[model samples]
Target: MGKSTLFNRLVGKRLALVDDQPGVTRDLREGAARLVDLRFTVIDTAGLEEATDESLQGRMRALTERAVDMADICLFLVDARAGVLPADQVFADILRRRARHVIVGANKVEGAAAEAGVLDAYGLGLGEPLRISAEHGEGMTDLYTALLPIIETLTPVDDEPETDVDAEEDPQGPMKPLQIAVVGRPNAGKSTLINKILGEDRLLTGPEAGITRDAISVTAEWGGREMRIFDTAGMRKKARVQEKLEKLSVSDGLRAVKFAEVVVVLLDAAIPFEQQDLRIADLAEREGRAVVVAVNKWDAEDNKQAKLNELREAFERLLPQLRGAPLVTVSALTGRGLDRLQAAVLKAHEVWNRRVATARLNQWLTGMLEAHPPPAPGGRRIKMRYMTQAKTRPPGFVVMCSHPDKVPESYSRYLVNGLREDFDMPGTPIRLTVRGQGDKNPYKNRKKSTPSRLRKHLGKGRADE
Candidate 1:
């Protein structure tokens, strides 16, 4: 009943969102769990709603059953207050049939009221019910004791590598998957596109407006490259996002964007450039994440050339910040243009982390300055002494100059666009900072104390001032 809460407790982070409302989790969210001495992977699944049809609940139940098949040990949680229901019995039977090992837990057994439910759990035929308060963190010792033997039997070696399920790949080891966050408005085929990439239906998808609530991450190898993809909830305009749940979902999507190295803004081909779409792309750019604009549902487009031109024109006119960013077209349903999308995402990440040598940067800066000199404000020239890259990953550069505050935004844009063109660093966000070198002399602005009258007289006598 408290699956997400228990998951957060075991993982020691609030990775999954929790609400009084059920079905907040639609995907299989995995986390590396640590319970005292035991460390293993734990999955938070959707509520077990019994539906065999292709409805959202049916899909969720299927996903949970798949997880059961994959999982080594299953933790079956039943609400202690509600006691064992018919649904709980159904789940118990399924677990007994499919699961390799199972532990029945009577969750929310915090006080005297849940005692009967705990007793009811004994009839579940899955051995003793571990009474645990996932919300209050009680009965954890019992949980730990129940899981230890299973873990010991399953674990290979203690000295082996401590690998986390969601670990970002290390360049020193195997190939590191590129981190990608796919975002857009409601029903933009974000999940559908990811499912195409994974070659399986991992994320729930249908005609519903916003089925996804959490920022769900899944790993895959696409187009001959490894990738850790995050499928976030659809974001809507602030005015339309009146519900608390919608607000939470939008905020969660924004968090996924921040964590991503590249954000793919999925646009419906029918409605390519909505106002909210521009805002989403701009948000990614402002956060310094590389952006890719992808138009989905291209297979249904009749006037493909006209639409492409229109999309291109609008992309440049509305989002100049993401100028030269990749605008790809793909049909998630038909799975067209996936290779191009993959290539574009990888290219954006490469540009985001691109670094230029200081020597090259200065050389380029000198040429730029000669070509278009800094403006003279009020007959006083703004002297730009030198420029050097301060950091990469959405490359950041600093210009040392005199009266740097006077550097106009227009001129800065000129330089940024110039860098993007010359260095082939398109699409990824670029940060340009102008700073004046501070005065070196410690007492340049001060009066040097004027050697107060008494001190001056003493200096005249002893020359010690």
Candidate 2:
């Protein structure tokens, strides 16, 4: 009924300890909590305590302080039945002094026990308190309204908002073509793979490698899905690359990685998953592009099984960032495995470009919250309110919570991993952002009136004058 139960409700799990026992939670247990159209970092904290800088309790105090420091806002939960206690007053002071913002929640608010507490909670000085029954999900509408501001405030300034709004509004039948970039080290057969897929020497090819000098873009249709394919020059290690043309090609390839929805890393099957191959894969991952690995020239390999096993092991060791990535062996020379490779590429691209409707995301979020509620650390429950997809083309999402900054990296990974699994988005990079509710809207009013019409009217008036 209090922060404890609310934390449990948000995490969708029983991980956050909730019993009649107070102060059972000690350390911070972080998890993803979904609220309406947003996802947030839900931190389970041990209750706030007074401790010196050097004691064990002090360290715990410091940890809680850190969590508060990271949070965009604090969900200051109070037991409505008990009314506002001296402890809540002290913690509210601490939150006001240090936290960027604070939201007061009066938990266990089903009956008369909540009325006095809810009234007294206003004395915490965090503003009006929200009455809620975390156990029964009562007063959620008020909670949502109170949290809207915090969510809007935490959105990254550099993030591109309204990215697909226009497209969503369009009456057009489908979305635009996906942009995919094919990249690899020289002699990795990048050009060969692209040319073969297109059924023509759209890109110049030769027995000699590194023939492609520039990043060439070609539009192609596969499986009824339109795609813009970028065929890039072979990348050589920086020190070994002395030619100006090679340097330009490598730079171009790197740029393509940034813009690509999916990056196909082709490797020579005879020496797959080498250092360079790993480097290319890592680059794609860091750039947040969906990745697909193609082992080219597989038909030429004599010890196929051993080589395949070796490649798999190398992938595990060198490119764990691309876990569950689709790995296909193809002989660009023979067109073997070509269909599988194409299918994998398309699938990966689709995952990268995926967008979940807000309603569905909220439903999934509730399930998550019920499964793994946020823990209590420093005697306070971290509240996660909602989650939503903010962008695609690598499928990024934002979770609105009471404290966005307080979300731990491990918990972020947990959310990202969950998203990949639940959405069948393997091989794609997923980004999870925690935003405190009610972030400010940056939209400003522009002076309006059709400039041409206004000018004409003004001219007519002036002529009459």
Candidate 3:
């Protein structure tokens, strides 16, 4: 049971995908783990399978071996509820040879049903197995005790005094990793594209529609930029997603989109934009994420120019909200057009984060007001006082005016489209909110008439009286 349950518990977040399906987690995920007073980096890997050839399971096994070789200590977890199986014994032998130090642990040992399995774990010859329940947070003290000594021995008690290196030496601070999430419908080459970017078969891919269940994340340096990329599960229609597992997978994908700064919506070359594809793109846009619509598998297309033009046309006509967003065509299979895709993503992110000066905003607003004056509704003029950028990273603006409530939706679109064209925001979601400046005197809500006692006192104090 090398599931990410313990990893999630230790990291204190549902960072890993969990389900009843075997091999749900096909990639290695690392997280900063905290065990009460102890802190360490934990790497959760795929389950150990006995496959040895070049099949998917075999590749997974090879990846796990790499993780084992790199780890200072390996915590080999076995399913206590299932008892010690032959596969467990075989994996134990492999770890003994490959891993430097191994600690055996029996996971899911919450009840008496698991006691026999815990006893059976002794046969692996990896020494005493800690009876722990990763889901219930049981036997954690015992686990803490087991790891304390090994951790102490390995980690130096004291090292060189740390310096404020970034704060003092570097003019600019550490670069923040750009958060990007690749989302699409089933079998749209999302994982394949990411695998090409990584230059490795890090994520499992096959002919199957939904081979990936978890929205896996990995760190990489792409196009000379550090990034944390999320590969989410394929999202199908809501009616089609009836199973519990699929629902969870879709939800995980959504959470990834929410966390990402740039959302790359991948479309299959064969079926460019399905109904589900539109929904996914709309979801990212509604979430205020910078959207980049990419058409994948371009190598298969014979009439490349025609298809490109058609896709661009469809993008504009379907998603006008993302009027200026970049639509790049790429082939994940042969890694064609990846450079263009990279440049497009970077440009989209730039536009998403671009902030305008208040003076420039006001100047642009004046031109817009002169071009199409706001309509006088009910014989009351809705004067737009001024405009200022309220925030960046999706670029929200506030327009102070006389009658914000009376502003027409069409006028709001006009201002938004103007911002996109004038400020070069393009495909990024721009938030334009109108806030009304008070119509009359400022103290309209205060008591208009004076209190009786106060008026009497004022009269008595008058010099004439």
Candidate 4:
């Protein structure tokens, strides 16, 4: 009953939205939790409910079931004040069958009023239920005790002696696995594509829209490189996302995009480049993430060549900010074009992490300024003196200029586009910042006092003396 409260207590922060009303949590929310000396990922899930397979509640139940399957241990909670209800028994049976490890918690058992319910929990055939008052912070010691053995077992034992080895043996070794997020509008086959990549039903997928509400991450090896893929909930237009749960789902998807190094904007070929799709792509670009556009449902299209041409044109016109980004046609349902998708993602990630040598950057800058000198706003010429790369992940640069603030945004865009074209970097966000010479010059505005003037002043003083 107080699952969110207990989750907040363990996580040491309020992450889940808790209310007196049931079903406030419709998605699985996870956070790194600490209990005394133990640390693990804790998931707060929706309250157990019974409904037909096609109902919305049933879909929520399916998500909870998936969470249970993913969990190492499930904390099955019951309302001790209300005793064991029939729904409690139904869900307890589910935990027994589905979950590998379960700890039954009798919540709200703060006083003698809950004693009878605490005893009744033992009859549910889950091991002895721990009486707990999640709101009052009770029974945590008992929880730590219960979890200690399991935690010790799960923790890997370092039996071998540590060896001294060079940590930075390879300067140009393989980079960390790319964190890729697949994002799109509702029913755009985000989950289907992920499932296809995983080659298993690791994620729950169906014909139903909004089936996925959580951003689930799974690791896979693709094309001889490891990849961490996030399968996020389908996003809808802001006006259409009126319900609270749907709003949370959309925010969760946005968070996935922010955490991602590369985002694959999956568009349905049947209805490619919708308004919502453009919004998602724009958001990714603003977040400075490498982007790859994948047109899904290619197998269902009758005129492949014409549709491909149309998609290319639409991509260039609708999202000019992400111009020259790889747009690959795919059928997530049929597993077609998956190799190309993976290659595009790798390429985008490479470009996203690209760095330019200072010499090369200045060379490019020289040519750019020669081609189109910066505008002289108010007739004050803006001289760009020097340019160097400031940082990489999205390739940020800083230019020393006579008047940095006076440099127009249009000129910055020109330089960014130039870099993108000259460096063969496409579909990756580029940043440029201008810095003014300012008062750094030590001799600026300094006047030289001639010897004659000094001698004249000195003579006047001598005469007064």
Candidate 5:
């Protein structure tokens, strides 16, 4: 229907993937789009197709329907070249019943041949159809005209005087929402957990593995803070990911992890701490994102105490880089232990953003050096002068030393661990760099010259002279 093309044009970016194949877009992607002077959130949905309730296509259709219900106005597009088929009429009927406002668009009308199809759209009983060429950038003025009346009715007018200026301001104004990505291996119950958090079955979930093929984001509020949660597709080992679509899905999930401030690595309690799970956790840590390990399917586990002990031991042994990170147990099926998960997420985010003052950091460094001094390589004691925090968002530090290259990895690890313990900054990635005092000697290399004639004459005559 060229809906994605129009979506790209309005957003001024190719956010939604387009292809000659139908149903290329299987997810509802939302973007802030501008058309002339009107600005609104536009959702590009999957092409309407007929399928059963259990098939993959059926789930895609279900997601599209949910998008329609959430939208204020629906853009019902039809291919002017292909004309209105039975499927178009069926979808039009559904939209007429579901959407509050409908704007019928006959797309691909770049030539006179599409006139007959443009007329055919009127028979769907959606009022007059607006002929458009989304590819050629034509008929946008008409679209703006059609949307202006709706926008005016929807935007509220303020008549009362503002008494409390601060109260009138946006509550969540100063801070950006926390971006969280929920990632895990296949059948790890990632979607179910997110749906529970949202208090709606916004994401499709089932017993089947690899059902999700896109990284979907939904805005939510948890503990009086705004959050944008991403529900990513389940990842499998690279060797097992044979299909092209699955590869794309995994790539998308990895991209989400990179963009996120915090990542929740969901694990199946029945088979917790698998090799793939460790890989995912390590990836999040390496990417410098705060990580929280969530062991799901707790309701099914009979030996809770032993299982928890096993989980803790495995977490320590397998991924020591993320030591002391929050390990939460949850049951996405029954919404058990969700509060703890939320608390852990918030706490990890706080720790990730922690900044240590220079005074406190230098004091801590002094104590660390006094407790166990740096090693003397080749009988030369490496003098440790001072230390200061370079930046936050993982807490990076720079230390002035006699020789930066001589600082052993073991000593660096010790300092990092001490900093983590002293500052109460556990689980967050820490970076430590060593720098040497560069070239303090003024006359490093002076050219040798013969003595001056006056000095030679003043010197007493010798046999060699």
Candidate 6:
């Protein structure tokens, strides 16, 4: 299919591997691509091959499937010289089932070779295929035309038209900026909560649930931080969500979760331990985001102390994933415990964005190993040689060990839990990766060698000698 040539021309770099043989691209490769004025995420998938189970081709099929699922569109390349074959038909069928947007490329289309292949591809039922000699860079204009509509629909505009209504109504000058999204199940007082905090009619407060749709993002300042607060619609059980708009609103709220660094899961003080609330917290934990649990309308509770203790106990027992997350009680109507809520959010955010020094991490690792040595397997003591912080933004660590595979998952969990407790990294996801030590020592060649004559002269070497 000559993907390397086409990829080079599009990405303006030799990013994809080119070979005379077939099926070089076995995994998904993402690169920012530009066609004329349009820019979008381009994914290169393996050349779809037919294979039975328990074969290399089967593994390639699975890999390609995942890439197809992730891509917004698929640019399927077919060899023009060979024309569309049975394998191409099978590949086209697979793409047609999975990818919503499929654009076909008839490669090596020079002189008379392309005419029949281009016509043959239409039989694959993917509309008219774009014929281009990728090596010579011809017929790119046609390819550009095919991509324009896809880009317009999928990619969002850089700037939206400034609404005059917002300009006239919104206040001028500096304000405290905080972008917070209030999310929970129906009747969680998400909108009411925000209205009480802002002390205004910024959001429409009501008793009936699921009133808000399309996350209502409000710009304001809290303490000193400038914030954009978002009020999202109530999320409901999938079976109960009957309306199309409700599903869309739920998706929008989910998207808000990704954009937010700190998510405040509002809980009903009356029914605090709902399954939906637990699921929301789990989502935040899985996404490696900071989370704060707000028990709203707390003033209404009769046995406040008993209720708080019960809730905390339940949280520990049920949500082990968010073991050290903050649980703040607040009355949305009266604004009681508002300060505590703000403080909890800031602290959680700090933990989420925390970074650990490599030296400190190694020191901690050394202490841990000394206290509880790694278990011996088959009479061989497994040595965890060294540790390093491989990545941040949720601080991930890599442990170089004699046997990576032998390091049990239970032990990894122990280290992760310890990290949360010892390092003050609560309510944030921490990754511990175990890597087998390579065959060659990186520092082995760097040691200075003493000459034989010098060693002999010093061989009155020891004071005893």
Question: Which candidate tops lDDT?
Answer: 1
Put down candidate 2 lDDT per residue, 1-465, tens digits, no spaces. 356578777777654545565554444556678777768878777667777565545655766787798888788888899887776788888898999888888888887766888899888778888888899988878877887777888775665556677767887857678888988888788777777878865554656666665566677786677888888778877788996556656787788888888898998876777777788888999899889998889989889899888888888678767888988999887788988987998788777779989888888878877887666556566688888999997788999987666677877777777777787878788888888886565544655657898899999999999
Error of 6 at 217 (Å): 1.5
List the candidate numbers ranked by lDDT, top first.
1, 3, 5, 4, 6, 2
Candidate 6 deviant stretches above 4 angstroms: 1-179, 377-380, 441-465
TM-score of 1: 0.93
lDDT per model, in order?
Answer: 0.91, 0.78, 0.89, 0.87, 0.88, 0.79
lDDT of 5 by residue, 185-233 (tens): 9999999999999998878788889777778788989778899999888
Superior candidate under TM-score, 3 versus 5: 3
> Candidate 4: where is the Cα deviation over 4 Å?
2-33, 39-73, 94-101, 110-116, 133-137, 150-175, 443-465
Residue 284 in model 1: shift from native, Å?
0.3
Winner on TM-score (2 vs 6) = 6
Q: Mind giving the per-residue lDDT tens digits that candidate 4 earns over 307-385? A: 8888888888899899999999999999999999999999999899888899998888889899998899899998888
Better of 3 and 6 by lDDT: 3
Residue pairs with colliding backbones in model 1 are none
Question: For model 4, where is the 10-residue window of minimal lDDT?
Answer: 161-170
Q: Candidate 4 vs. truth: CA RMSD?
A: 3.9
Error of 4 at 160 (Å): 4.1
For every candidate in turn, the CA RMSD to the true structure comes to 3.7, 29.5, 3.1, 3.9, 4.0, 16.7
Is candidate 4 or 5 superior in TM-score? 5
42-131 per-residue lDDT for model 6 (tens digits): 666566668856465665576677778877888898888888999899888888899989999888889796788888888888988898
**Which is the winner by lDDT between candidate 2 and candidate 4?**
4
Best by TM-score: 1
Ranking, TM-score, top scorer first: 1, 3, 5, 4, 6, 2
